[model samples]
Target chain A: MSKKNALQTVPCESCPLRKLDTLREFDEDELAFVKTFKHGELTIGPGAPIVMEESNSPHLYTVLQGLAFRYKTLPDGRRQILNYAMPGDLVGLQSSVFDAMNHGVEALTDMLLCVFPRDRLWSLYTKRPSLAFDVTWLAAREEQLLDEHLLTVGRRTALERVAFVIWHLYRRGRSVGLVTANKIVLPLTQQHLADTLGLSLVHTNKTLKKLRATGCIAWADRVLEIRDQDKLLEIAQMEDTEEARRPFI
Target chain B: MSKKNALQTVPCESCPLRKLDTLREFDEDELAFVKTFKHGELTIGPGAPIVMEESNSPHLYTVLQGLAFRYKTLPDGRRQILNYAMPGDLVGLQSSVFDAMNHGVEALTDMLLCVFPRDRLWSLYTKRPSLAFDVTWLAAREEQLLDEHLLTVGRRTALERVAFVIWHLYRRGRSVGLVTANKIVLPLTQQHLADTLGLSLVHTNKTLKKLRATGCIAWADRVLEIRDQDKLLEIAQMEDTEEARRPFI
Candidate 1:
């Protein structure tokens, strides 16, 4: 059964995010205001680019469903994956405010995003300051995540790096209601993993083999199955970050 | 003459940032509101830790003068320098709103900061959404810088990484009125460079030697003299990012 077929456009009045345990609840007036802000929804398939570097975009998005990752390509053509944008994450926020994007975002799965005109962000700020704070909060949260990822890539050993990225993704996926118990069906391939971890494909494979040797994880096909979550966290030398109640539009 | 001695407290009514071309101007009312928000000033010497990880601090700061770097330390005590904070940049913003900081910031030189109570941020948001937008603008800018830094560390070659970081710091310093002609007096040492670039001290030294041999740059007694800025940019495969008029407080 294809899960994509199960998706439907839910009205903003009864947005599914309001029912999620991980997200904050908006008051009736706030909810009504946000409904008017929604211009429409966008659906893109896997491997599709959403925001390209230096391209002035007219709109920003909130991930309604599925996963995506932000990356930047060097002039010489080397690419580095910055971070993932799961459901409930705001996309192209920096560009919407600062200017054109310096990076790009690509969908990892069939993704749905709530669209908003970039120019109207000012009215949201003026009329709804609390919502504006949530926007800033989201930006700060992204900065915090990028800071942690930099630490992982620059300082962690290869074994630890692979473990860290997996654990990090699993935790983030769980927060956005994308996980099912110990399993996560991620859309990334080994090449994507190599680009993200700053390791060669062969080295990334070898590191994954080492993790498999520990009998704590199993990766076959697209599903990542964690047999022992605590052991994985132990190897990663970190705990899952606690997600506070955050607003989504 | 020490520039440190020339630094004196300037009232918000006639702040010098309005005169600088790189920073945005504030209207009279906005300036008056910011004046009331100012708690006091803090002075710290080089090598002092300002915002420590996990420390609950009641105040956030705007860099009135000098430079600082944000970093994270691994459990084994390895450190990764995230990015540098220059004059007019807000420090501890993530902590002030989101929670305790996940990273630490340290002074690279004698530093002065304008402090504001964290609790008053809400009032600022409610009363002055334009200023609030400016605050979010700063956070978004920081995120953009960190994203670029992550790409450099994770994807760029060792030589390119060295060129990129130096060029980036030079451009940022020039924007905040901290540079003179083609020279930037950085307060960081080569060890700091090693930590930031994810290289050993010896490798960082070797990389510096390579850059120095190219006749594009000179580093001695803590000052970086760019003999050929264009050459450095070419090697890094990046242009110096132009700063838009940005808010100070």
Candidate 2:
């Protein structure tokens, strides 16, 4: 499928993410430049490839709707999910800088992405330091999440891993308005969980069953509901850091 | 202990890392700007911290010499070593961008770090898009390494984890001129390995014994020697990617 869209549509000032307190605001000139810089938006269906690995694309993206994930595959076809991309999360920033994607991004649900030209990124960096810094902040936030995931996969027990990942997703989803009250929809399967948590499918189901038995979480109809958020955090042994206002561009 | 150093002694043009093929070279103008932007150098002894979690330091760092590791600690004292920093590695880019360090960096050996003012980072972004791009590149590289570590931790078998980490360190060290032929000084203890690999000390020792029995590796006297590099890579099921010239700052 063609990754490029026909034309620019969304004006930066009225962008949906501007209403969220979670993201930092852009000044007038910055917004105008971004509006011009944004080429268009592209939508993909579930299980669609947004950015393929090893293919050099001259564009970067930001998630405008739905969910997707970044992942890598071994030579023997073993896949590992790196992290999920939610609304307002910048996609392909690493690829834009490094000039090659070491991993690929695939949509979990139907996804809409804001497209920006990779060639103009240098202009953004030179003319808009705040925006450039925001990009760095986003990359750093991603790195922090990966560090946490690495620890969870490497050190945490099976039960703790399940609890921790659920809590992590819940918090991030809530921050981005994907979660309302105690419920959030996750377009993931047992296979996704197994790959993400580094467990066998059987083990993932068993651990998830154990978590369900605690009455702290309910997962059904692709929606996960937190019945006892405190208990889950306690089980996970995690304290959420107070994240500052992040930038979405 | 203080994480501060007294004065700036080295000029940017005379920076030792510029001599290495591993790092990208800066033009004269960029070099002059960086020399003025740099605040000073700090010497940290083994086991001392370079950046502490939650502390707002006004400076970023680049490793000039020796080794260090970044990590996070649980409230109950569980520690997970995220990744190592060798010569020519940018140390505090994440923290400088995000404002609060989500993890801590500690020296694995006596180390020297070139300190740069965090406030002037915007200057680099505005005046030197290339350097700003390089900073993002460094952060992206770090994220990529973390991705690999996550996959190793979450998916690889115990023996594979052991084999992979050793190969990882050996390759990274070689790129930065820290390795000589088959030998590399790690400056890490068994406990460090246990923490880093998410294994117990006993398990770590046993795994090392198994690796040594294969006639592919030797670890003793704080130094690791590779015996058959190809055999180790085969055991790890890995291929080393050819890394391009990296930016040290």
The DockQ leader among the candidates is 1
DockQ of each two-chain model: 0.79, 0.68
> Local distance difference test, per candidate?
0.86, 0.85
CA deviation > 4 Å runs, candidate 1: A1-8, B1-8
Off by over 4 Å in 2: A1-9, B1-6
lDDT of 1 by residue, A1-249 (tens): 123223437778666666788888888877877876777778999999899887978889999888899999898889899999988889988888877898899999998888888888998999888899899889999999999999988989899999989988888887877778788898899888988988888999999999999988888889998888889988988876677878776
Worst lDDT window (10 residues) for model 2 chain A?
A1-10
DockQ of 1: 0.79
Chain A TM-scores, one per candidate? 0.94, 0.95
